[model samples]
Target: MATFLFDKIIFGPVKSRRLGVSLGINLLPNDCKLCSFNCIYCECGWNPDQYDQKINFHPKAQVKESLFEKLSQMKANNEDLDVITFAGNGEPTLHPEFSEIIDYTIQVRNKVFPQARIAVLSNSSMIHKKSIFKALNKIDDNILKLDGGTEETIINLNQPVGKFNLDNMVKLLSKFDSNLIIQTLFIRGEYEGKIIDNTTNAELEAWISHLQKIKPKEVMIYTISRDTPSDNLEKISMNELEQIAKRVDAAGFKTQISS
Candidate 1:
């Protein structure tokens, strides 16, 4: 079984393939994966056992304090930073104090590294909520995930919890009006006797349609860069990613390949 990647609230001024040097803020519990989607490719592993691993969501005050401490230390040492990203064990918008945290993060970031961009890596599950949407609008990089277009592909790949459907997701995302960035992860292989591949002509065509509807500022297409929970999955190569990106670029939408 795969385990959680981060064990702390504030972690890593780590090098990112897409975002440059990033400081990660983990709002979910440090011990378990708390997510709305039980994705097959999740590095934090399967979610069936997550309920048992649930710990209290860290308080907003503590998160701010910890983040401030880390940022202060980094500033003291004159560490370079490009982005302060909210990405960790699982979905970040699920944090009850998400809006407040975003506000505080902006304040702290302005004081420490005024030039650093504040980004959120969201699954778009909570974008339907007015508070979440409003808060996301305040950030520099509001990157949301759109792994599949069809409901079958979504269920097979992302396995979203609760009442989530593609049409509603499209509606919510379109509300962002090109202010947001669309992120898609392409992968191939099998899981539980079924073949899984999002790089197919049918999937790509459907995804492109959705991208056109959203009209995002940019589209980030990427593949698994680390060990996923499932052994049956395989990463799509850079060449394949570029081929797909070419199609997206031709569609008049800005695209970035993060393979």
Candidate 2:
């Protein structure tokens, strides 16, 4: 498997294809991947073997302290920043003190890079919680994933390990009322013995219908860009991505294709 875990509380002011010059903040454990969904195309590999022992997550004060130091140092060095993104080993919203961390991050970010946007890349599994929903609503870019419109496709692609279902996710996403950004990943290949493709006509029509229902502020369409846990999956070409974007745009939703 092609594993790419970020073993740190704070990492990278790396170039993001969509977010641009982003600084990452990971709220999960630094030593392993902890997520609600085991996405087939995740660059972070499968969840760690020591999942039950993952109780040593960083404390909120420590996260705040580290973020403050890093942001202050970056500001001192005059490094340009476009966004402070919450993305790392796994789902950031899973943190017990996630709301507190976000509040602290916004304070520190405002002190250092007042113009920088606070963005979170989430799987949209926890939005059902009122607290998670409120915290996400405070950010500048609330980017949530909607990989598949149907339950079977979601299970095959995202592989939610809990009671999460596509029907509830769609309903939760629609609650944003066009205030959020809808991110969709298109892929086709095989994982295990089954054929995996969310780009089929049936899938696309269903996905587009959900997009219409959600009525997001923007629709981000893209495909695989890195080595995935499932090696057989292939990246959809830029041309194909553009074709999908065109269709989304025609539906009266603003679209962006990150190739």
lDDT of 1 by residue, 1-259 (tens): 4555688899899999999999999998877788999899998887655376445788999999999999999999988999999999899999999999999999999989999999999999999999999999999999999997677887788878777789989989999988999999999988888888888899999999999999999999999987788888888999999999999999988998887
lDDT at 74 for candidate 2? 93
Residue 128, candidate 1: how far off, in angstroms?
0.5
Best by lDDT: 1
Per-candidate TM equals 0.96, 0.97
Model 1 per-residue lDDT at 245: 94
Each prediction's whole-model lDDT (CA):
0.90, 0.88
Q: Relative to the unseen true structure, what is the C-alpha lDDT of residue 250 in candidate 1, on a scale of 0 to 100?
A: 91
Off by over 4 Å in 1: 1-3, 50-55
Worst 10 residues of 1 by lDDT: 46-55
